[model samples]
Target: MAKTSSSHYALKFHRTSTWTMFLVYVILLVSLPDSSQEDCHCQNGCTDFPGSPCPGTTCQPDWFGSYCQKRNIARGKSTSQSSELQGYGGPFPSDKAVDGSTDQTLQHGSCTHTGDTTSTGAWWRVDINTTLEIRRMRIYLRRQNTDRNMGLQVNVSDQLCYTLSADNRQQTVLNIDCGEALNGSSVKISVNGPYLTLCEVQIFQCSNGWFGDDCDKQCQCQNTTEVCDKETGNCRGGCAAGKHGPGCQQECNDGWFGSYCNKQCQCLTASEACNKETGHCSSGCAAGKQGPGCRQDCGQHHYGVNCSSTCGQCSGTSDCEKDDGTCTQGCQQGYSPPLCKMCAVHFYGPPCQGCGHCKDDSPCSVLNGTCLTGCKPGYEPPLCITACIPGRYGENCLHTCGHCQINGSCNAQTGRCERNCQPGYMGPLCIQECADYTYGINCSSVCSCLNQSEVCDKITGDCRTGHQSTTTAAAGASAAHQGQGYDDIRLIVVSCLLAISCVYAVITTATIYRIRRSMKILKAEQMQQYSTLQVRGESSVYDVIAERSVYANESIQRHGDQDPNKN
Candidate 1:
């Protein structure tokens, strides 16, 4: 009545066979690395990332982490069961990427990689194993630890999706349009650093900027232009030129403000009295106040106005009476006269005996605002109207222009001018014309001119031929042609590498799958045989091998046609 070892083994095999096979199936579904990961280059035109894969071309070595840059998912439950089957390592947040799998028709088992897989900086990325037309994408994060966090960032490309960040542990949700990658065959997602575990990822058919069932557009202020939350209409903190503040609100800088930061304020200095509101200073202050706001009076013998004109020393008293600026008793009745006015020559003055015949040769003829002596050479004219022309400069055409005429600046000591024409301006004073084929900021580059090549000015950085040349007007084609040349070379190299990678990926995956399948079948039969033998029944190793042969053949056939990742 007691079971033998062989029988016990057989019993275990039969009881656990279903679960075992299912476990193996699950492993195959999730654990196996996707073949698409190997040839992740995009099939669609590169629109988002700077150097993502292009249609009909393998990606160049350079990469951008996200498949479609920063995308938001518009819909789908974050906890759908089918999502678990999406091929990737995470049911939990992963270090390298976030990805999923489905039974959509596959070409090369394509997937996406997000964020950087290389840098020490935070990064995240993802890869899609099958082609699915996505509606939208969502990337969400909750209460972040800013100090510990570098920041939250994501990039998605067609080939490899990578994600990384110093403080990405709070990130939780990311949704993307399934259709976006459907035609291309892959979706890549990346993060700057680490992102918190995902809740779910759903694919739907939605408009480019639309999100949710309502198809509401995303932050709409501008394309990639950081705007304030769409609902609030606030712009992002960093703004473009001439714009400032959250969503570019509250412009204020360069001494300007109000609506557009265009208002200017006057310059103020400690020595001048300034208008409080406008910051301008028009005149001196009143008595009792001195600095900046001047309300103080004059000193000692001086009183009103500016403390400049002085009152005479009267014979009656030592000080002037109350601000009358003169002795209340009147210069001791010294005959007659105002406080400080000097006496005329014929009539005795109160302060100086007289004006002393007022000499015309004294040079102070202008009085308060005059020069004490005759003017110098260049300074002879009343207003000094003329500036030295061309070759002449200084007090009276006194100095030579420094250096040669080719350069333009005078000598520091003599006021002489000099010149250096650089390349394009090859003539005298750096004014001669440049070569027929060169132009740029420094004249260091040649015009990549062909048919009607762009003729840039050799001396002044002006386009010598653009106004007359037809080639200058066809910039678009020229640019495209250039890109084509570079792209063609890049494509050739990439294609070769991709082909090799794809082939290697396929072979490796098939080998692993076959080996794993074979092992499972053999193990199961061994268990079965052991159980039978223990029960006093018999079955050989050959029986176990035979049972798996058919399954093996079928697996091999399937791999030949279907994608190896799905296997």
Candidate 2:
């Protein structure tokens, strides 16, 4: 029975040991990362805080992570389905190597340093999830193993691309070019060392339509090739036609113009349309157009593109000057040179002032209005601009007529008496005087009897000397010589009338003193005649007495003339 109990205990112990081994294996399987999950390095602290050391040197600011990989899948939870990495023990599992965490970097209690046991020919491989044009690969060493050199060899899609045999010295990172952009989806790294340690493994593929390291640069191939240098971003086959410059952004040369330099030039013919930028006509403006821009028409009185100027009022056969409008030949009859416009009738000069009245009806000089002849009437000249003063007349007002009846005014033009001349003077100009023996009304009357002198009154023509008794008869005969019977009769009748008037005046003056004496004598005589002449009447007697008295006076005057006055 002790033997049976020992066997039962051993069987129980064996079952428990099997279950423990299964459980332990299950735990390890749960902890180990699946190779089909986890794609691209996140670059962790380096990506989050630029310029911070990534712990491993493989990733730089120009790249993404310790392995300098590219992110090819959609980020977050979706990234795990896109890729995987095959490796060994780390803070996490081998597939977690590319999660972008370093040996020191931890997240949620998980660390991402991927390492393997020290064994012969340890290797790590990455499935990039999609086909990619792979150019370069970098490996980041475990930060803790500073002195060790793991001579690594890299292959892309089963093609051996690079070997690290020449750089066997200890290094934090390693970079290798895969020759051309090797068409591949998987990258494998193997090292001939005791073990392989990788904090992270990364696979790179350029983003869609990109070809450079970080896929941050764009390709500018103008011809639609859309291909350029992966590093320099230079066009692979040069820019397309009609394009120039390194970026293929410039157009054609100077002589060529237009959108694509497709249009030919017209400036060669006439030098028009010359400017490349503005396409303006530089020279040779059209017929009527002028100005620098060839946009203006000729100005007023100007013609042609040179703006040749012209003006009005030109005369003579010779044409006017286009530049200044000056007359070339002589001026026209009434017009002047430079401008031949006519002047007003009375005005003359270059600018035609008043001509005034000219002497002798003479015309003035056309140029200066100077009176050629003397001034007319009251006017005087150089220019005939002034008039004569009061009582002055004739050309230049130099002469005077002294025979005016009252004030002595004369004609301004002729210097003749405006009215009749003075008593002795006659003629239109009042220059003639009465003759010595003749006078009165144009000197037509003759001198007859005189009282004082041989001369007669100049205005009346009556003799001034006294005449004798013999002269009276002579005067009558002389009167006959004066003209016709009218003169003879006129002289005799005037003498008799004057003698009768003198006698009447003497009788009337004497009557005042002898009125009473004459009345008494008349009364006595009338009484005697009144009775004797009663039959004849008183009126007849008085008439007879008046005749006798006139005869007596005449007889007495005759006696006194012969006696040389009784004094």
Candidate 3:
């Protein structure tokens, strides 16, 4: 109720303003003084406003009726609501009026008005800001009649968008030919009173076109030009060259594609896929396509009717699908079909995604026991169907599943068929490789051989004996072929040691004999050295011999000294 009261108050205020403005307008109209018939004052009005003056160079000339009466009647209107009941606005100075010298029929009377109602301020102060696109225009008259001579004029633009005058007010239709698409805030309009009032206006896209010679009431406004030919009504834009629709706008008959499309999607067969651009159904599918999306595989399902859904209930002739003759996984024991895709009464998993009661372990063999590729990990059921019950793995709740022996899923990668037989497997797919000290085909059976013994080939579980060349081999023969048989290695080693010993004795004897001869020579050289360096008593032998000769000389000297004394 409060909101409603506020709206009522605002509306009342608006009506009061309108009524006040209307009263002022009427008072001004009544105050307007009549001019003499001789006055031709349009000569000055033309210079101020855009339009040319009347032929006599003044308004109210005898040639025309009284201008004020005509102008007032041309723009007047009846507003029945209890608001300001005033006539339309009057002419303004500095306005642009249409060129009316040439055609008198195109002119408006002397008193012209120009204004727009705006919410920002005084409505009469706002400028007409719509820039029209289409070229032709018509003026609409309310009640003011005499101000009809003035036409429209635009000050800023060189190209013409529309024409307007009081005469056009009488004409029903108008054409606005826009030379270009414009983007701006406003377009100013100056009609002859050059008088003007605004209804609503529109702007069109570039490349506007018209058709149909008699289209006075109708103009087709559709983008119809991309079509091929006019006869086909298929030029991409516009009504096919020469034709037109009701309001200069209607779609073509056929052979076209667009918002004005007259075409259809096409392909080879009626069911075949079609191109969006062209309307014709042409080439068929590529190699594999049968149903729709080139989707099929006779090599996979091995069935009929475009290999539709997996070949169920197959006939006998095509037993199982084979690529280059490799026997594929076939059907179950109870059921035998062409593709091996289905199962009989109590069989499933590997055969059909079916259900059954697996009574015994041996009966599992009747269906091959494992799921289609076996359940994922901890998951395991009757046929490895359900999970292995959290703690258990393998076919039944038989083994545990954890980091598994192999790097993959232990229960899944290897079947827990072996009962604590070896380290690698406990159930079935003994996937783990041989660990240290262990070697066997399935790592099932242990070998009693030494570490890295080359004692046996684990894969075959047969002793791995190496070979040797008899001619140069230290062992004298290959372990496999020799009488040693891994036992004769010691014998060959002893023989080789004995042979080395005999050769060593012969070499030792020759070395001893040579050493003896060299020793004898060394003994003689040592004796000479001893004689040269050894002393007898205090002197060496050489020294002692020289002393003896010296002693003899001394004795002779004694004799000579005695003789000299005698002399």
> In candidate 3, what are the lDDT values of residues 43-99, reduced to their tens digit?
334332212324443443211212211111111221111111124333222221221
- For candidate 1, the clash count comes to 120
360-380 per-residue lDDT for model 2 (tens digits): 667687778888886776777
Please name the candidate that would achieve the greatest TM-score relative to the true structure.
2
Query: In terms of lDDT, which candidate is strongest?
Result: 2
Better of 1 and 3 by TM-score: 3
Reference-based lDDT, residue 69, model 1: 22
TM-scores of all predicted structures = 0.17, 0.29, 0.20
Alpha-carbon runs more than 4 Å astray in model 3: 1-139, 142-159, 164-175, 191-268, 271-287, 290-567
User: What is the clash count for each candidate, in the order shown?
Assistant: 120, 10, 86
Winner on lDDT (1 vs 3): 1
